[model samples]
Target: MPTTPISPPPIDRTGRWLASLTQWVLAHKRLVAVAWLVLTLAGFYGSAKVTGALDENFTMPNSASTVTNERIVSRFDSGGGTPPLVAVVTLPPGTTASAPAVRADLRALEQDLARAVPGARIASFGSTSEPAYVSDDGRTTFAVLHPPSSVVGDNGPSGSEIDEETVARAAQAAADARVGGAEVRLTGNALLTSEAAGESGPAFLSETLLAGVGALIVLVFVFASALALVPLLMAIVSIPVTLLAVWGLTALTEVNIVVVFLVSLIGLGVAIDYALLVVMRWREERERGLSNEQAIVHAAGTAGRAVLFSGTTVAIGLLAALVLPVPFLRSMGIGGLLIPLASVAVALTLLPVVLATVGPFADARRLRRTDRAERHWAAWARLVIRHRIAATLAGAALLVALCVAAQGILLGSPEARSLGGTGAPKAALQQLERSGIGAAPLAPVEVLTPADRAADTAARLAAVDGVRAASAPEGAWRADGQAVVEVLTRSDTNSQAGRATIGALRDAAATLPATTIGGSTAQTIDFVDAVYGSFPLMLALISIVTFVLLARAFRSIVLPAKAIAMNLLSVFATWGVMTLVWQHGVGTELLFGVGPDGAVQAWAPVIVFAFIYGLSMDYEVFILARMREEYDRTGSTDEAVVRGMAGTGRLVTSAALIVFLAFASMATAGDRDLQVLATGLAAGVLLDALVVRSLLVPATVSWLGRWNWWMPERGRRLLRLPAVTPATES
Candidate 1:
């Protein structure tokens, strides 16, 4: 049969090498199963005692920030100057946002809060903070509540505290506060982020589990074996054990649960995901009458190499996150690094051993009726093949349009209303707001300059364009030899205006030769800066590694380029959708829960993009591999592209579905901000899986024709990549 060039698989693929290795590993699946069972028992039992929903953003670099938060926490430990928060208060009709009744009500509300909250020694609130109340326009007013903390060293409760009664009061007060005219709204970090995390966290769990199971089910169905679940189970072992390890390690180091979760999910998903590919390929080798050990050796050599490339590509891509200055990025990088490393370990060690032990499980689902989805995917492939160029161009065009939209997206600071799930802390914020002291929404931008430079920096800031009202002097803070400067935001403090103030202050301080800004807002600006600057490095990492891996995998440079292009395209499209829904506020009001007034959080885009890029690459690899397999067999690029599309489409779609479901589940939580984020992710995943991968990727690959695989022939030798080898197993 004359073979033609295949663009790449329209379907997602784990590649031939992965399939073969999985087959070889299945030989000793029983031993792998037993080992996993024991490990699960030991790990789960150990962590069971402390198992519960933690309110803190699992990603915070608690080590560094904890000290600062603790200091602030300790000051009011006995409760003195700090005010009682009253949120969810009613305001009189026809009164402006800053009207007297609203202002008086704020004071009354603060007093009411002091009287209502039983545990405090002292509390205060009034109309003075009113400018910040109702958000300057007076639509939202909140009195500050300084919850009295336990005396120093007394452990004044973990933020919202796990106690039931306290939680109940917080809730009841919020609900009852909407009396006399105002509808109360409660929000605060403790409540907001907790709720946000609650919504997104479980969805993540569900996505991981479902993806793992879905992959397993596919394997069993493909092999007509009931035991296909074993290998997948082997992969699941990595997630929980890894998470606990991540938790304990984070207590000592800087990693967080998000890192742990992502790594574990990727490790489990990709590991098991790749493991299946390796196993399937190895099985083909076995069916060819190769001896068990030879098949294992062949699988390892061939599928193993592909697994190595895929894992290495993914690991390298994610590790780029480390270059970022923030803890979240570092956590992502380190976690990403760990997952693949772990995956490699299992694939080479436990996987190989298990496959040898439980090859019988491979046949368990062989006789089951073929899953309908696979057939549907096959039909899709034929249609794509029949109209390759037009299909491809159409797909490419769509992705490009989406990509453009994604680029236009914006972000804002997350607010209490945005935080949907974490309830108790939110109640506190609400209580504070209802009290009518403004600044509830203010993320204080604290600045400290050398005492010598303080006045000048303060003066420059005082005179700077956006200074709503610079305090008589820089407010007092405890930075040594540094005068603290607090600049009330003038509209754009959280927008370009806010960024500009930060820049001007920074620039002015730089000119002073001794001034600097350091506070939550300042830190946020810095963090955003760090993330923005490092994003290129992250993209470069993915691109370079992808280029290398693709070239090697296909023995051609062009294939990798096409794959990466598609992956990026998926990201762009996802972003465009997010920008429209989350940013422009044209139609996003209802989905995210809070009023669409707040801008998107500045940090969400980088983080979200990071996730989108990495996961899309996962799909790209799967598709490319399938196409590669077909190309290798028939030597026809076009035919191979179609066949590969048919082969891997169902799996990729299912994988996307699981991921989508995981993210969307977050929307159900209490925090509105998180709900929006979850919605964005869910939408992105759906588009990526069904639209980009299924339709666009296939069509584009078809249209690109041979050019999709067109690499500069002479350039391949320049990278000095390892000599590619066909799998020994099959």
Candidate 2:
């Protein structure tokens, strides 16, 4: 009789490589530890040098806004090279701003403000020849100011001291308070922008601290010993290294200030997450009576591989954002990608060495309370598997409901009225609107034409349906062979009606030779075009590439496809929640200290998608990889699902909380965009962990049974993955 041939052992190249790395780390633990410390020191030095290079200004090359910006720098004489800022003083109730007494007081106030701020050029009511400076009602009058140095020059911070926007509004407010007859308000694009950007420094520090504290509490609860400190140590080593890499990138191109916060906060959470997974696996191995070296090697072979794949998934998602033309989004992509790369480096190399040498001491003090809830994950897994259809249906229904809300999302840029602050900038804008001389002129749909046609262009723009006023102001310069006509709109620059006005102006100006429209409205239009222009392509590429990678990673077609679908659903749901709470004011007043103004920031949806897609996949990879491994060993899909959930549930929940708290910290920034970013991320993490991974994933896996792990021979060959003989259901 012919003997049954035994199949050769399945290829395990990744596991073997990881095991070798772990052994090497164990052999040179001391040297590895020292090297990481030295690298960390260098990272700190690089981070300090980078702080001065961070910039908030974003330039979209070749876009209408960029061309407009160039034109302004070359032609505008009023506000130095900077955009004009308006300071208005509303006369008490019935008094007119043009009255002799009111005019005299305004002139004195302007003089006082000029003195208070060095290099200020203020055109007070009595000094300026421009009719726009005073409202027709005479109830409101304003002054235009610009920094003397900023005019005719463009520069960013480059030295030990970072450059800051001049706070002329503060000085003007003080002067108004001192003079006391009229109500003084400073509202302009410059001042309002400064208020929003000014909070980054303090916000960064606060978010970082809060996230760290929250993570620390969770880590302590999870490990219940000195072992809790290891993840933090990894984070301490990871952040500076990531920042240094970003600083190096800045040498080649511009990097946004927001990237620094992302590196500090998100990087910290990701670093700890990688470390926690590895350490927990190592502890499990040790509990099975393995030697320290053996445990480290085993943990590296299993959990380290998961961390590597997970980091790669996240990095791929972030780097995909580079496909967008927007510089700010690109910077965030590159910088966000660096976080995982640097964190993975620490987790794979330095973490193993640390654990090999110091882990036992920390593990000695295990949890004394012996909480039974920690062991309940296995039971939860059994219950879910027993009622898989119910769990799957309920989860799908909830996710679908949430996604329906995304249908109502309205995208637009933020406006002062909706920024939710009591600062001088907000007050000033309010006063300007109340006085019927709001900053509409400051955000006109600029029409650039041949100098000869400037008059004709202005006349045409003025005739547009939404045009409030249009002028080819006298004395405007034309160094670039173009004349500028400012077309003011009746609606706010970021409003729907305002955007419609921009379209109408463009249509009206289309007949004019050499005409181009540029201004706030133009910028908004360009931004939307750039984002959506390639968004569908970007989304397809990311999805296809992610699916291919996951297929190779888990060696299953159905699982990877399901994972992609589930992740996309999670993203849509998160966007819906964001739209409801932020754009629609569902909880704006109670949660964010401001009311919704009918639109979400234009960039928010794309930014959140890039982040949440990758992050949601993180939990998917973590949980499903374990189940895959268990299934391979047991040849029973049901057993694998239950065992995987029992082994990974606590780790997944804690990791999710760590990241959620980190994002939630962004709410402390007090900016609408930041809050939206925070909300999307926090909500995505919670939903993915508790509902998607915990309920949907297991239920679906159980329902699919053996098909969950099936891979055809042709497909396995195509992907160059190991082949496995089919096993019958247990």
Candidate 3:
């Protein structure tokens, strides 16, 4: 019997277009380089100006909590979703709040505080005589100042624009002047969030530089030559250009502050990854005896096409966030969408030019070791293929275990202990905790009701389970036929019990005419419901679209199905890691110096799913695209597995390490949410590259044999592709 001859691989319009574009870029390398240099400079300038434009607000439009908050702000001119700043006053020793002189002093201090913080509605034992405002010892009295929500400037209505330091200072000054021998400190949700924001992790610039250094080290090790610098150069151009786009986006709509860190770190990782792919392919072409220009074009045609597909997949994952109702999440989606697009642009245009010009000089200084990585990876791939059943079983078992672990993830606000901060806010929080007055005052449920029904509402709420106290203040809390009844729960609102309490309160209030619950806690619940209520839709959209995209890119139904399944496993495993580390406190204290938050941040999972799904799929594309190409060239499944792993194993792992370093640097952020987010990203990338790409993908492909290349004629027509003949069929 005679062996059949292998046919040439099919080239699609995208590959041909990329080839032409690469030729164009090569002909105008100097112009392309100068244009990127100018864009980088503009991006640096834009990054500086963009911070002021970023919004920190989290808003859910048209929800009950939102409408009630708007009503409260409009009518009472205070207390509309923003947490009230608490002024904790410790009187001179042995002076009870009931004493005439102490009462007089308290009343005087209240008046002074009202004057000190303009547009602040003051509620205290002195003003309401509610008794709940005083500690059991009676020596500590507290005041709640509901600041005007309208004070928030054009930055968007999350109340982040309020000058927290100035407010704290003015309140302290009032306490010192009016209440002799008394100490007062300020703490609130707003103050704590502000302090956390003020606390620096590694500086953004330092973190970026650190990530760059780490990436360079990995690149150096991978290439063992000066060619390593090409990827870094691409990253340098990509990050700034993305930032510049973000700044322009800010002018059109609100961009979240978190996008800055994302653009810096994720942009660095993605840009470098794209460049690494193109450069590696170019070098491989050169090693095959192609001219420098031919290498650039061939690399562009192959790896360039993969980069485009990978970037589109990333953008598609982020696009799911746009369907969410929350404003900040939508902004995040928009900002994150820019990262991959900018990276793709740089990789396709500027990267080819850099390789054509600087690449030869860089590649001239060759490493002593040649083909060692490929040989090692080829050996590993053979071993995996030889034991395909065992490899498949082990990988599946690990992923299933992680998926089981993820079922326990709790979604809510971070625990109080995890909101680490220093100075006056910390001191005040400590003081309040010590005084036996729990955090109820910080997250009280504000009931908006008719003035005539205010007292009735408070009385009914007080009798409900989990209710610690309820007070309907007469003076400042009432305006325009609306009365505010503040209800305190026995548990902190950030806790599970507190969330249940809030649900109960809403249930109880549902029967009352013209009554609704609104506060920071209520808004948090609304936010969770809004973002997650539509989560299934977002997940479906991402899944279907990604499957279709991958099916087209890989030109096979089985391959795309396997890719999606592996990507999901990678993501869920990442979530499981987060739950164990952050929620269960398995290694949180040892690693991050924080206790279990008892829950992951409410917004983290969705963002993680969106990002990790796409990012991990990058490795899938890198590996399988090569496998497909190899299969086309050799018409042998076993050869495809070995050669594909040999081609991409080092590149995939190196790219993953660079991305991991970027996220690891982000984990140093003071905010717990950022820490969790970064941990998820890093874990997901590492897991996908090392396990999914290395072992599971090869084993499964080898097990599937020639079925990996099967594409139905109808599917090929849908993608506008040539009909496929299985590699095994010749």
Candidate 4:
């Protein structure tokens, strides 16, 4: 078909730049396509040769937990006592608490556990050691098993001691318990860890596979052409290569699987997502007036730059997690930095080549859908613009309210045995209460005094407000010249009082003895310290990076600031939901079946912040790219906001759904931690898609009016920032 020639057409700078860019792309199609194919194959082959880097705690080197594991290892090497485990002896509910059968059964369990797991010594007894470790009632009994260092390394404790192949021989000495006709149960750090791993594994595999297939289906439904899926098909091949490369690097370095897998997920997800975004726009460009070559270049230069800007901001934000002064977080930061770069490279190279070869088939139907002006998205944008003030206020208020609830969150405690009333820890705790020690929660405090003043230090520690008892064992291997004090409290250890208890113990021991606390309680305190302290720094880094990058992308300082603020607000809102559902016991029974005891997961806040910040910026690019494009033509912020939000809303929602589905599937894993994480992430992304991107953003943009285009003088002079190409107003 012959195209109409332009005569005295509009002389717009943005359009002229796009036209020049298209001419440049058309001139080099063959070379670019060939190079893209070569790179894609190479990336795939490399990943295939590399292994899958998983967070296999048992196999993971000591580097994952350097600080904590190093101390435990040194202590064990010095002949310090081993870590303790819990063994539960169950009896019928109606049975007498002090029955002879119960006592005999408890003794038999001790022997059986020792035989089953060799070197498993009894750390404490319910009757003789203390009552706090067990329950006050007599129906439950606890045998704390402390395995010797010979079998399990302190750095990475062995979860599978008796292998399946050797279990028969090991089981020969194991006592088949029938205590008072109730089945005996044993569960603690070891058992729970084992179960959580098993659950996360299969679910991770299944969800990954299902998500890949679902993403493909969404592409097909959206584009309605197999050729449209070519970009994604390249991604499908590239992800494995990326994953293997990550794994291979890990064997030689400290790079953990979290970086590899998460990056792969986001990389493939975003690469495919970006590919879809550009391909459709390419089709639209062709349909408008340009040849295939001109159209592909226009898509790449415009949408390409948008994706590039978005990817960098996200990468930097995630990378900042490493700056938290923590190791695990550092690894995650590295992973964040690498994966997005890989995704961007693929989108730039692979997608362009695929489009070069199959651009014609993309819009083969040549049938444009009608009623676009009255589409769901256009109506939504109008509603938001009409109610900009009200909608923006509501959104802001919602985030503030949720953040207020989060202020009440307490540190989590995994030490006590009386959580939900169905385990060994509780039984042992109940026994301790009966013995007059378990009534109140306490933080354990161990103090090492100079030999000359050991007795004097112990006497001083005993007088601390929360110190229930202080034992200064002379010449004991557990504490060499140390006074190990048991500090009891009137409040739970996870509470404010409990945190105060730990600080108090340290202060009391500072002058008397050099002290340390090593227990489940100690681990909780350490976690709280690392997470809370790092949160502010994390927020600052993310806010700065996002603001700088987005500002550079649009040459608009105010717009970028808005984007970062909106992103943080989304994360805050998610945190609020978590606090209500997890910390405040609002949805505990319905969601997890157990009433929440203290705070959400120790790492939840950080994880939410990282994911939300990275993903929210995705929409920022989609909307802003179109806004920038429209600004070039109309020079009207309100027009750009409506046009941009409407034009890309469908694609944005599809991308959000892909991420949401992938995360939500984790809820099926059944582990409490996994379930909570999946919920928080999915909720955040969902809100970003509907509430933030769809409603809040356009409303705010409408209110900002002309100021939305304001940019720092420095950005304007660089010219590296792409000039906005404004199309004629619809």
- The estimated TM-scores of all candidates read 0.71, 0.87, 0.91, 0.80
lDDT of 4 by residue, 1-730 (tens): 2222222113234334543444444456676667656665776665554434444332222222233333533543321222344555544666633566665665676677667766443422323344333345555544554454555432221211212222232223323655566655554443333333223345445656666777777666666666546656756755654664565556665554445445555655666766767776777777689766666667776776766777787777778777665555566677656666767666666566567666686557633452363277777877888899999988777777876876776645433332354434344345444554442332333343455665566567667776554444332223333333333444445555665665676666656434444433445556567667878887887787677667766678888888888888888788877877776678767765666645676666676778778878877888887887777667777777767876788888878877776676566655555666777888888888888887788889889887788764567666465454334333
Prediction 3 TM-score vs. true: 0.91
Deviation from native of the Cα of residue 58 in model 3, angstroms:
2.6
Off by over 4 Å in 4: 1-72, 77-83, 88-112, 126-141, 149-185, 192-203, 365-374, 411-497, 585-597, 712-730
TM-score of 2: 0.87
Candidate 2 ranges beyond 4 A from true positions: 1-11, 77-84, 87-184, 189-206, 369-374, 421-428, 431-442, 476-482, 671-673
**Once model 3 is optimally superposed onto the true structure by TM-score, how far is the C-alpha of residue 548 displaced, in angstroms?**
1.6
Q: lDDT tens digits, residues 338-413, model 1?
A: 5665566566657666666566465534665544655678788878778767766776777688778766655545
Error of 4 at 505 (Å): 2.7
- Report the lDDT of model 4 for residue 423: 37
- In the range 532-626, model 2's lDDT, one tens digit per residue, is 79898888888888888888888899999999999999999998888888777898788765767567777778878988888888888888888
> In candidate 4, residue 74 scores what lDDT?
51
Q: How far does residue 461 in candidate 3 sit from its true spot (Å)?
A: 1.6
Order the candidates by lDDT, highest first.
3, 2, 4, 1
Q: Per-residue lDDT for 668 in model 2? A: 80
Model 2 local distance difference test score: 0.75
Clash totals, every prediction? 101, 2, 0, 19
Candidates sorted on TM-score, descending:
3, 2, 4, 1
lDDT of 4 at 730: 38
